[model samples]
Target chain A: MKAKAFAARLALALVAAGNAASVACAADFDWKKFQGKTVTFLANNNPVAQALLAHKADFEKLTGITLKVDGYQEQQMRQRLVTVMNARSDEVDVFMSLPSREGPQFAAAGWYADLTPMTKGAVAGDYDYAGLSQALLKAGTFDGKLTSMPMNIEGPILYYRTDILKKCGVEPPATIKDIEPAAKKLKACDANITPFVSRGLKPAIAYTFSNMLHNIGGNYIANGKSNLCSAKGKEALATYSGLLRDYGPPGVVNYSFQQISALYRSGRAAMSFESSNELRTVMDGGERLKDTALVPFPAGDAGQVPTAIGWGMAVSAHSKQPEAAWYFVQWATSPEIQKRMALQGIAPPRSAVANDPAYRKWIEEEPVRKQWQAALDVLAAKGSSEVGYPIVANPESREFIGQAVQDLILKQKTVDQACADADKGLDALIAQK
Target chain B: MSEAAATFTEDRQRLELAALSAPAVIFTVAMIAFPVVYTVWLGLHSFSSTGKQSFVGLANYSRLLADTEFWHGLWVTIALYVLSLVLQLVFGVWLALVLFHAKRLPGIVRSLFISPFMMPPVVAGMMWLVILDPSLGAANYILQSLGLPPSEWLASPVWVIPTVALIDTWQWTPYVALIVLGGLQSLPPSVYEAAQIDGASAFKTFQRITLPLLLPTIVTATILRSVDLLRFFDIIYITTQGGPGNASNTLNIYGFRVGFEFFNIGYASALMLTLTAIVFGAVLAFNRLRGAVAW
Candidate 1:
C-alpha cells in the first residue's frame, strides 16, 4: 500500500513537469506542432548537402518531423527539379538552387514561392533573419521576392603558395594588373612549378572569365544588345589569356577545377584561382598547408568586383504544405544549426555565427584555418554575386563567351575578332523572340 | 469436301496468318513510329525550359539555318566520321591478317586483342581521360621519361581531334578486326593454294586475291561504322566536351546539349531530325554506289 501511494506521487510529479515544459515551449516555439509531418528535400550531392545530411537526425529529433533527402549530382538534381516544377507537382517540398544563376528566371516563371511572408511568421523570432549576410540576402532576392535562403556564398578566390612568393622576393598580387608581374617573378624563382592556373574548359571558363570581364569594367549587355565587343572586353580577354599563355602549365587549356585543384594540391602549381568551395579538397590536410595563402579575388582595375555565387534552399511554389516546408527551411537555417555547420569550415551565411568568438577561437586553433577565415570574412563582405549574364539565356550565353575565350587562348582569333563574333551571336540569341 | 467449303477454309487460313503477324506490326508502330511522329510535332513548336510549348512553325529551322555553330557541328561530325573510320579500317585489316596467320596461341592473342572492344564506350572514354590527363597522366609521364617532350594532346586545338581519334581507334579497331577476321576465314583456302601453285609472291597474292574478295565485307563494315561515327558523342562528351573551344563538337553532342543542358526541347528535336535526314541521305547514296561495285 505504501509503494502504490509513492508511485502515484511520482506520476503526479512527472505530469506537473510535462505541463511546465509544454507551457514554456509553447511560449517560445512549439516545434512539436508539426509532429508526424514529413518534408522532402531535393538536393545536390555538394558539400552543403553532405553537411546537412551528416547531422540531419538531430534536426528531426528537435522538430519531430520526418525528413526525406533526395541527393543527386549537380546536373541531375537540376534536371529532376525542372521536371517536378514544370509539372506543378508538390513532390519536392524544398530544393537546392543556385540563386545568382536561376533566381530571376525561376521567379519570372512562378516556380519559386515567396519566402518573405514565411520569414515574418510566428517562428520569425527564432530565425534571426537580419543576421544573414546582406550580400546573400540581395542575391537570393529578386524583384522583391525572397526566392530562396542562402546556404553558401561560393566564388572565385585566389590561393597562392607563400613559399613561392618568398622565394621569388615578390608580394602577393593586390590587383589583377599585379598578377602578370607576380607570376613572372614566381616562374623566374622556380622554372619547375607552374606559376598560375585557372579553368580553361568551355563552359567552366566562362565562370572565372566573367569576374575578369566585370573587374575590367566590361558588362555582358549594353542597351539591350550584346556588348562583349567593347574595348574593356578585349583587354579582359587579353589579360586572362596572357596569364595562362605566359606562365600556365602546358595543356592548361584542358584544365577545369579538378585539374587545377589537383595541380595546386600536388605542389605542381604555385597559384590557382578557383572557387572557395574547394577549400576542403586542397587545404584540408597536407604538408604544404603551412605555405598556402587565401585572399579575395585580387581587386580589378574597374574596382573590387569579386565573383560570388551561392547555393540556396527554396520552396516549390506548387508545394502542398508551403507553411510546413518553410518550417524546415527556417529550422535548417537557424543560428544554432548554422553554427554547427560553420565549425566544419562551411562558410556561414549568418554574420553572428561568422563573427562569433567561438568561430574566431576555432580559426585561431590553426594558422592555415586563420588565413582561410580571414579571407572568407573579406569575401563575404565585398564579393559581387553576379557570376554570369542575368538573361534567360544564362547557360546558352555562357557557351558563346566560353568559345570566345578559348579562341583567344588558342590564337584562332584575335581578341577583337573573337569578341566581335561572340557579340553578334549573342545579339542574335537575345533578339530571338 | 465441296468447293465452297474448301474456299472458306482457305480464307480462314489467311485470317490466321494475319492474326499471327499483328503483334509485331503493332509493336513496331508503337515503339518506332510514335517517338518519330511526336518528335516531328515538337520540332515544329517553340518550347523553352519551362515546358510552355507553343506552335512556332519553321522558326527553329530558319534559326538553325543561319546558325554558324550548327554548320560547324555538321562539318566536325563528318570529319570525325571519315577520320576514325579510315584509321580503324587500315589498322583493322592489318591486325586481322596477322591474327589469321598466327598458328601458335592465336586464340589467346585474339581474345586479348579484342578486350578493348568489350568495354563500353563511356568506360573507354573514362580510361583515356586518366591516361591523357596533362599534368598527372601516364601518357605524358612515359613521354617525359623517354627524353621526349610531352605533346599537349587534348589541350591544343590542333591535337584534340586527332588525339580523340587515336583513343577511339585503340578501343574500336578490334571491332573491325573481328568482322574482317570472319570474312578472312570465310574465303576459300583453295584460292591461296592456287596462287601458291603459280609461285606468286605473298604480297602479290594478298594484293590481287585477298583485297578483291574482302571489298563487299569491308563496304558493309564502312556503312555500319559510318552511321555510328556520324552521331558520335560519348567519348568526346566525356573527354573534352568538344572543348579547348569547340575543337571537337559534333552534331549529336550539340543536339544533346541543346536538349538537355539548355532545355530547348523544340530546337533539339529539329537538330536530331536534321541529323537523321543527313544520315539517311548519305546511306542511300552510299548504297547506290555500292550497287555498281563488282563485289
Candidate 2:
C-alpha cells in the first residue's frame, strides 16, 4: 500500500513539471502574423534545397506566405548573388551560403541582414532557439550580429568496402599511418582495383587536404604570415600527395567529387575519402549498400580534428521584406523541417532533431546509415571550421593550397619547392588584406 | 536642275543617311567602346568590396608586370593558340581538297561532317571530358586494342596543351574546311584547264598555281580564328580548369578566376586590359599580312 502511494505521487510530479515547461513557451504567438506576404529565395539547387522545396506546399499552407525560388548551380548561384548584392538590389530576399568559405567576405561587404534581433521577437511559440548547435551559430555570427542559420552539417569521411578489406586480410584504419599499409595490402591482393581515391583537382584539393593538414597539426598562417613551409605542413603535403601518387587511380590529378564518387560506387576503389554528403549518391545503385561502411577519417597527431562546414540560409541586407524573409529562414531551419530533411541524407544542425525518435528509427533501418550518423556525430562534436586561412581572402587561399598539392601529385616539384612557392604566393594575398 | 534645288536634295540625302546609320553607331559604341573604356578606368583604380574606390594609378599595372604567373599564362595562351591554329588550317585545307575531288558526297554525309562545330562549345567540352577519361574512357581502350601505349590525355601536364589543341581542332576543322571549300569553288577553272593543256602534273599545279591563290582565303580564316583561339576558355575550363600545377593556365582563365572568384577587381581589370591589347595587336598584324597576300 505504501509503494503504490509513492508511484502515484511520482506521476503527479512529472505532470507538474510538464506544466511549468509549457508556461515558459509563449502560447499566444501567431503563425499568420505575416500572412499574404511574399519572399524570394536564391537557392543553390543542392540536396538541402531540393529536400526543403519538396515540401514547399506545406510551408505555404502553414504560414500563408508565398515563396518564390530562384535556383541555380553552386558557382552560378554565387555569381548571381554577387551581381545582386553589389547593386544593392532587393531581388534576392534569402539565399544559401557556406560560412567557412564566405562568412568573413560577405560580412565585410555588408551583404547579410542581422538576424539576432528577429530571433528574439518574431518566432513561433515552440521555436526552441537554444536547441541549435551553438558552434554553428557562433560560426554564423560576425560583429555581434547573427548573419545566417546552419541548414546542414557536412565534412569528409572514409567509406571502405567491408568485403574487400576482409578478403585482403586488412583491418580498418585507426590512424593516418595505418592507411598506407592497408592500401599496400589491398593493392597486392588485387591489381585491377584502385586502392585509394580522393580529390586532386587544383580548385578542389583544398576541401579534402585541409582536413589532413589540421589532423597533422598544421595551420595555414603563423606569426602573421603564410606557414605552408613549416615542418608539419610539408609533412602533411608529402603524405597526402604520396598516397594519391602511389596508390590512387591514374589521372587522380583531375578527379573531384564526381569522379571519386563514381569510382567508389562502381566497385573499383577499395577506399574513398570524400564528402559525407555523397552518402545518397554512393548508395544509389544499392550494390554496395550491404558491404560499405563509413567512418570518420583516421586520427592524426592532433587527433581527429576533421574539417566541418555547413550550408546556411541568410537574408539579404537589401531585402525590402526582411521580416518575411526571416520567416522563410526560420521555417526551413526549424526542427520539424530539419527532421524531414535528415531522412533525405542532409544531416541536421539541430541537436533536438538529431535525437528525435523518428530520425533514430530512420537511421536504424540500414547499418551503413547508422555508421554514417555516428561519424557525423563525431564531426559535429570535434570538427573545426578552418577549411583554409581565416581571412577575407579565404576562397583565394584555397587555390594556393590546391596548387601545392597538385604540384606534388604531378611530380612537377618536390615537397620543399611546392610549399615554398605556395608560401610566397600566399604571403602576397595575406599582405593585400 | 536649279542650284538651290540640288543643294536642298543633297542636304536631305545627308540627313537620311545619318538617321539610317545612327542605330548601328550607337550599338557599336555601347558594345565595344564603353566596355573597353570602363575596363581601362577600372584598371587604374583600386576598388574594395564595401563600395570603397580609390585611385591607385598604375600600381595594379606595376604588380602585373612583376607577376610570374601572368607571364606564364601569356606563354601558355600563345602556345595553345599557335598549335591549334596550325592544326586547324592544315587539316581544314586537306579536307576541303578531298571534298572538292570526290564531288559525289551524299547530303547526309556532308551534313554529318558539319555537325561537330554546330554543337555548343560547352556541350563539346563536356562530351570530350567523358571520352578522354583515363581509365573508363574508350580512348585508352582503343589504344590498348591496337597494341599502343595508353596515354593520360588531359591529366599529364606534359601532354595537356597538345591534347586540348587536338580537341579544338576536332571541333572547328570542318568550319575551316567550309570556308576553304567556298574559296575552292570560286577558283576560275580557266587556270586548271590551261595547266591540263600544258600537261602539267597535278602536284606541280597545286604547288605553283593553286597554293598561291588560296593564301588570301587562308589569311581571312586566320584573322577570324586568332581572335577566338587567344581567348580559348570553354574546353580547357571544362576539362582541366588550369590544373596540374597551372600547366594549362591561360591568360583568359587566370583573369577570369581573379575577377570572378577572387573579386580582385583592380588586378583582374589590369590583366584583362593587357590581354585585350595583345589580341588587338595580333589582329592588326594579321590584317597587314592579309593585305600583303591579297593577289
Candidate 3:
C-alpha cells in the first residue's frame, strides 16, 4: 500500500510540472511558430495599407512568413473581395474591410471567419488586446462573432484655413449652426475663393453628412421605419444643403473627397470637411501645412456626435490557412506596428499606441497635425459609426439620404418634401430587411 | 464518278463545313447565349447576395413598374439620348461638310480633329471634369478673364443633363464626322455635275441632293449612336455618378447600382431587360427609317 501511494504522488508531481512548463511556454508566445507559412493579403491601396506595407519587411523579418499582397483601388478591391468570397475560393487569406459598411452583410453571407477564438488563443505576449477600442471592436462584431480587427480609426473632420477665417474676420465655428455664417463671411471677404465644401456625390455624401445628421439628433431609422421625415432630419438636410447652396463652390454638389481635398489644398477654400484618411493628400505639397487647423465637427443638439469608422483586418472564412492569417492580423494590429503606423498618420485603433511617446512627438512636430491628433482623440472618445441606416441595405440606404440632400441643394424640393421623398425610398429598403 | 461517289463527296463537304465552324458556334453558345439566358432566368427569380435565390415570377417587374427611380432613370436616359443624338448629328454633318470642302487639309490636322474621339470615354470624362471644375478649372478662368459669368457646367441639377450631353457630343462628334465623311466621299460626282449644269446654288443642291442622299448614312449613324446613348454609363458614372439629385441617372447607371451596389440581382436583371428592350426597339425603328430612305 505504501509503495502504491508513493507512485501516485510521483505521477501527480510530474503532471503539475508539465502543466507549469506549458504555462511558461504560453507566456513566452512564439512569433516564429508559423515560420515558412505564406499569407495572401488583399489590401485596398489606401493610406492605411500604404503605411502598413511600408513596414512589411519588418513583419516578414520578425515572423518569417511570406506576405504576398494584392493591392487595388478601394472600389475595385471590394469587387475583387466579393467575387473571391462568393466562390468560396481560398485564394485570399487576409483582407481589409470596412466593418461599419459591410460587416453585417458579410457576416450574414458567412464570408468572415470568426476571429474570436484566434484573438484569444494566438495573441502575442504584449498584444494587450484590451487596449483596442471596445466601441470599434463591437462595430466589427456581428451576432457575437468577432469578424475583424480595427486597423485605423477615421471619420470626417473639419479642416479650416486659419488665414482665410482670420482674413474674413470670422470666429471659428463653435456649433453646426455657425458654419453657414462663417461661410458667408468668407465668401463676402473673397469672392474668388470657394467658401466651403463637403461631399455631395450620392454615394459619398453619407460619410460627411452623417456628422450633421447625428449632431442634429436625427436617427436614420426609428420604430422600424426610416425617420428622415422627423423634424431634426429635415433640419439637417436643409442646413447641409443650405450651406452648399449659398456659399459653396459652384459645383459643390459634385464634390467628394478628391475634389474637396483639391479645393482645400489649393488654398481656394475657407473650410472643407473631409475624411481623416485624406490627411496625406491634403498635406501633399505642404502649402496649407502652416495655416490649416483641424477640429471635430462642431457641436449641435446632440453635442458633436462625430461619425467614426475604421478599416479592419479580417481573415477570410474561405481561407485555407485561417490561423496563419490571424497571425498576420495580430502582428499588423499589434501595439508596436500600430505605433509605427500612427507616426506615419494612420490613426491607431489601440489607445496604447496613441499614447506612445514617439507618436506624441511626431504629432507635436506640426501644428496642424497636432490639432488633427487632438481631433482624432475626440473622435475616439465620443464618435459613433452610424453613418447610414443600420441594415443589410445600408449602402443602398445612403443613396436615398444623399438624394434628399442633393434635392435640397438644387432647390428641387422643400426640406419637408425632400425628407418625405427620402423616407419613402428608405422605407422600402427597410422593409426589404 | 459514280452516283454513290458523288453523294459521298457532298457528305464530306458538309462534314468539313461543320468542323470548320464548330469553334465559333461553341464560342457563341458559351459566351453570348449563356449569359443572356442566365440574365433572363435571373430576372424571374429573387436572388440575394448570400446565394439565397427563390422564384418570385413577375414580382420584381411589378415593383420596377411602380418604382419612381426607374421612371426617373428612364426619363433621364431619354433626355440624354435625344440631346446627345441631336447635337452629334448636327455637328457631325457640319464638320463633315467642312472637311469635305477642305480637300487640301493636312493629315496631321485631320488627326487632331479626330483626337477627342480617339480618347477613351473614362479619360475624356476625367479630363473634362478638371477643365470644367467650377472653381479652379481653366474654363471658368477663361470665362472670368473674358468678363463672362462662369457657369456651373456639371453641378447644376437643371443643367447636368445638358452638360453631360455636351461632353458626349464633344467626344463622339468626331466619330460621327468620320462616318458622314465616308458617306460624302462615296457619293458619285455625277450628281454634283448634273446639279452644276442645272445652275443649282450650293445651298439648294445640298438641301435637295446631299441631304436626301445622306439620310440613309445618317440613319445608320443614329442607330449606332442611339444604342450607345441610351445605355450611357461610363462618362456619367466617372464624372457625377448620376448625382446632384439623380439628374443624370441613366437607365444603365441605375441598373448597375441596383445590381452591384444593392446586390438586388433579380430586380437589376429586370431593369436591364427593360433597358435592352428599349434599345432594341429604338434600333428596329431606326433600321425601318434607314430602309425607307435607302436609294
DockQ value of candidate 2:
0.53
Candidate 3 Cα outliers beyond 4 Å, as residue runs: A1-40, A55-70, B49-51
* Fnat of each prediction, in sequence: 0.56, 0.60, 0.74
Worst 10 residues of 1 chain A by lDDT: A19-28
Superposed on the true interface residues, model 1 gives a C-alpha RMSD in angstroms of 2.0
Complex DockQ, candidate 1: 0.56
The chain B TM-scores of all candidates, as shown, are: 0.95, 0.94, 0.97
lDDT, each prediction: 0.83, 0.89, 0.89
Pull out the clashing pairs in model 2: none
A111-148 in candidate 1: lDDT tens per residue?
A: 88999977765363457788888788888887899989
Candidate 3 reaches a DockQ of 0.65
Pick the DockQ winner. 3
Candidate 1 Cα misplacement greater than 4 A, ranges: A1-41, A56-71, A80-93, A121-125, A318-332, A355-362, A429-433, B1-28, B48-51, B106-109, B285-295
TM-score of each: 0.87, 0.93, 0.92
Candidate 2 CAPRI-style tier: medium
Where does model 2 exceed 4 Å of error?
A1-38, A60-65, B5-24, B49-51
Mark the 10 consecutive residues where model 2 chain B has the least summed lDDT. Answer: B45-54
In angstroms, how far off is B109's CA in candidate 1? 4.7
